[model samples]
Target: MKADVRLMVTADGSHTAINQTLDKTYHSVHGAFQESQRVYIELGLLAAFEKFPTEELCVFEMGFGTGLNALLTAREANSFQRKVIYTAIDANPMAVEDAKQLNFDDLLATDYLLKLHECPWNLPVEITPWFTLTKQESKLQDWQTNERFHLIYYDAFAPTAQPELWEPEIFTQLAHLLLPGGMLTTYCSKSYVQRNMRAAGLSVEKHPGPPHKRDILRALKMG
Candidate 1:
């Protein structure tokens, strides 16, 4: 909410959160956006998507920061000829004009950046014949959708910054929204987060983290 949260270009010309509290960036100092693409998009979502049938993939993202994950997913779906119904929730929606000013176009290429803005808000907008995006400018806790998702990207802020969002009750609710055998991937590997996932009826696993991160959490809903 603070205007002080300006995007900083990292050493590798990637954008990242410049935390006012710590006076540091939230992601890697080397390549902020590049690290996110590798960790969340490639190792997390894309890897999970590859395991399942690609005809129709339902994806839900918790924090749609900069729409990086969403844009990457769209590009992948288009390339693979996979149909995707992407639902993303963000409490504080960024201004489209401001987003346009960011270096996302430099990172993801110009054409994809344009398509990202073209994807409608609060309604399903077709990106391709097979890929559609439905964005919600609301808190994840308040989101109520009957559509069961096959994959979830839990990219909330650190628990320390926003503890309420990481509570067990939230995870329980998310579990109910996932289809059986669906997977949830997160950058957090905290024990409390793992416990919450288990409480929500998911089988949890730990995987090697991307670059600087030590570990990451992946939970699967088993019927």
Candidate 2:
């Protein structure tokens, strides 16, 4: 979104985008690939499968900055023989055109990174037989969806970088959009953030985080 955007190599040899304007990066600098798989795919999506026991799931992703979570979720859904409807919203997807340069293809064994970005926004585009992605360039605060999500990938910038995004009022609004038994996963386990989720009427719990981080959060909406 700006001339100051740059691609960075993370610990797991995958790439992440840094926005100099916001002083924030899309993924964890510690290890983008590891962080993405653990926080979103392995933890978030799988939890939904356990709770829902369905072959199909709808996901609402807070940030589609790098499409790393989208890619991994697609892969996981394929492996699990499930259909994933991924709705990713990003206010301004930074370095998206340049995101093709990331080393994720080699790591993921799929060259669909550019395909993920080039797909038209505001419409569902089939990225694979098992995955359909719909990108929405809308801010989370202003986002309204008629569809409820079974899983939520809350991959926004850190609370410190964008405090408003982590506010309790925002989570309270998001809580109404979750299907019963749905859950949300995020790499942030800050006490305040957990409090926000709890305040929104979600059951919050702490889980082990990826490398270099102590804890992550998984909040569930019971049926």
Candidate 3:
């Protein structure tokens, strides 16, 4: 792990990293893998698959973090035999060595986690026949891409920790990146966050969250 980032075990016996500088963990303390599965996969990716059944799925993730979400998503793509083009951006990406500290292999029973971290950044790498990953080392505000997406994983820090990221203008920009009928899922469900989604012209819905969290948000771009 980096000097400021340390690994911790969550309630589900899965690994998560704590950013000492931000005073925040990359995932919920309740369960890292569980949270990713519920919020990003079940809510975000699976919902997109159902909504746009036959199309090759395109996904944009705001915070790549430990690549837990990508790992899970790749697993699903392989399982479902669906093609996924995943692009993820982070202002400060964790080192591959640091990512190795997370025991995703033990949790998912696959070595793809290490492959996800070690893959070259800023270029798409085929992790599996069904999954392609393009990692960008840039902030969401500065990221430039011509691609629109079917789903977005908005796993950013809490609003209290990074309030500017949760603003209406940011949500508006994110909304524009989504394809019609596309959606975004995040761990945050604060009233102001939902209001911001609505302000961004998305239809927001509240869903049951994973352990330790009461609710999560899913905002869709209505065609």
Q: Best lDDT goes to which candidate?
A: 3
lDDT of 1 by residue, 1-223 (tens): 4223467777778676654653544566677666667666776667667777644788998977667777778777777778888898877665566566667667666456556654677999887776788888788878887789888888887887878888999999989988887888888889999999899889999887766777888888997
lDDT of 2 by residue, 76-136 (tens): 8888888999999988775555876878888889868788988988999999999999998
Score each candidate by Cα lDDT.
Answer: 0.76, 0.87, 0.92
lDDT of 3 by residue, 39-58 (tens): 99999988888988999999
Better of 1 and 2 by lDDT: 2
Candidate 3 has a TM-score of 0.97
lDDT at 67 for candidate 3?
90
Clashing pairs in 2: none
Clashes of 3: 0
Model 2's number of clashes is 0
Give TM per candidate.
Answer: 0.88, 0.96, 0.97
Candidate 1: where are CA atoms >4 Å away?
Answer: 1-4, 18-30
Ranking by TM-score: 3, 2, 1
